[model samples]
Target: MLQQVSFPLRTECPPGACVCERERLLAEPDADLRPLRLTRMEEQKLIDRIEGIASYEELKRLQDRIRTNLGVELKITPSPNEVRTLRGIVILLEDRPGLCKKVRQSIPAAVRKALERHPEITYAILDANDLFGM
Candidate 1:
């Protein structure tokens, strides 16, 4: 009589040679994905900046600036369901595969903070894999 054991396959590709999305995502530091905690003044300034946004181009510019300054990616758009109001905005924290555990865990708090500070933004959603949807 003989006994045999099976082994699970490696899910991750080797470093430097990985071409998969997960590998690329894992390469980025979690710190970059996580938004910095700002002071009350800084938070107010950020909200003020967002509050005065009058056009899509301006919003896009702010998004670029945030990405450049904070290394945190954000997408802003008009709320699909709420149309007749100027303040009906949706803030989406862009999502992708292979985000580190720390970054993934921080997303909900990030969304909450975003919503709490800006009444202009009606919804803050996590795109792609929707943890909040669960």
Candidate 2:
């Protein structure tokens, strides 16, 4: 007697081709998800770094640090209204599949908090929708 084994279908999605439920949930701001909490020190450090951002280069470095340290991808761009100020800069946290749900939920708030505390980066309208577009 010969036994046959069947392999499961691939679970990973190609770039820009994901249609999974998890991805859908992550994209929804109102979706109920457990939050991942950062330590007090980590939050403070993030806030300090955001407050210190005086140029696009610093923002890029901060993105790199976040990706490396937190295993999360964020696309940061300056808003179209002004290039001279950090106030309108936009930070888009990539909602790619397989990202930790809790982490994905927590970062927007943390970043928003940082932006609020920043002297130069404060948004004229400190709305999460405007800043993070999560």
Candidate 3:
């Protein structure tokens, strides 16, 4: 039998603080859902809504709406100079068991795909190991 558990969503900041509510919702097990359920038309509607947002508050509201409605977390990171120069992205992935091997096997293809997607992102390099101060 499936049991419903209600957990209080806690935030370190006030209700409107950056990512507080989304973090709380993410922490709740019952809130996790797949993003693939949204149809292409619905996704287009959301993209239009996001594009129309004019302020930070509106953007945050849109993010929250997407998280609740679509269950997709959009992670946008600024590329460093090396990454922009097509030299590579030195990503120090978490030092866990077999992580190095996994990164070595997977990151090159992912990097290629990213480069293909963004003209500005010329290259990507994932350094799963500590290669500094040798």
Candidate 4:
């Protein structure tokens, strides 16, 4: 039972804040779905990485790291969570069905590599909407 939900994209929406509710839902860790499961610290690290992004050059570097290390191209952009009234950037790695599960599972390694290799990314979601359109 998958459906398409529209997410608003702000003009200056490069890593504003993350829409929390939807992300919470996707990250609930129900065995039925394989949303990336991160420990609390890891989650904070992920957010830190996102917040660390202060410039476009840093963003491009993060993108390159993900592609080079993970062999995946990602679209780094701002994402908004209307329910939580927050906005942040999310890294769109892939969109094919169930692909997020794979990405989510691999996020820890990816995050470590990206943060280590660049040490400047200072910055990171998985959702169907975020998926197809990220």
lDDT of 1 by residue, 44-81 (tens): 57656665655445555777876675456776455556
Q: Per-prediction count of colliding residue pairs?
A: 0, 0, 1, 13
For model 3, residues 1-134, the per-residue Cα lDDT tens digits are 22243432222334443332344444555654233234345544554554444443454465466557545443223344333443344322222221123222233334334444554332111221222314
Looking at model 2, the pairs that clash are none
Q: How many clashes (backbone atoms < 3 Å, residues ≥3 apart in a chain or on different chains) does model 3 have?
A: 1
Residue range with the least summed lDDT across 10 consecutive positions in model 1:
1-10
Candidate 2 per-residue C-alpha lDDT over 1-134 given as tens digits, one digit per residue, 9 for 90 to 100: 21121422123346565443444544666543221223335555665666556644565578788777555677655566654555466666776443444445456655555555554444333342255555
Ranking by lDDT: 2, 1, 4, 3
Q: Which digits, one per residue and each the tens of the lDDT, describe model 4 over residues 29-132?
A: 55222222233444456546744655546656766765563345666444555322112444455543222343443554454445445433433222323534
TM-score of each: 0.37, 0.38, 0.34, 0.31
What TM-score number comes out for model 4?
0.31
Score residue 81 of candidate 2 by CA lDDT. 67
Q: Which stretches of candidate 3 lie over 4 Å from their true place?
A: 1-33, 80-134
Judged by whole-model lDDT over C-alpha atoms, candidate 3 comes out at 0.38
lDDT (0-100) at residue 99 of candidate 2?
Answer: 45
- CA RMSD of all predictions: 14.9, 12.7, 14.3, 15.7
lDDT of 3 at 113: 42
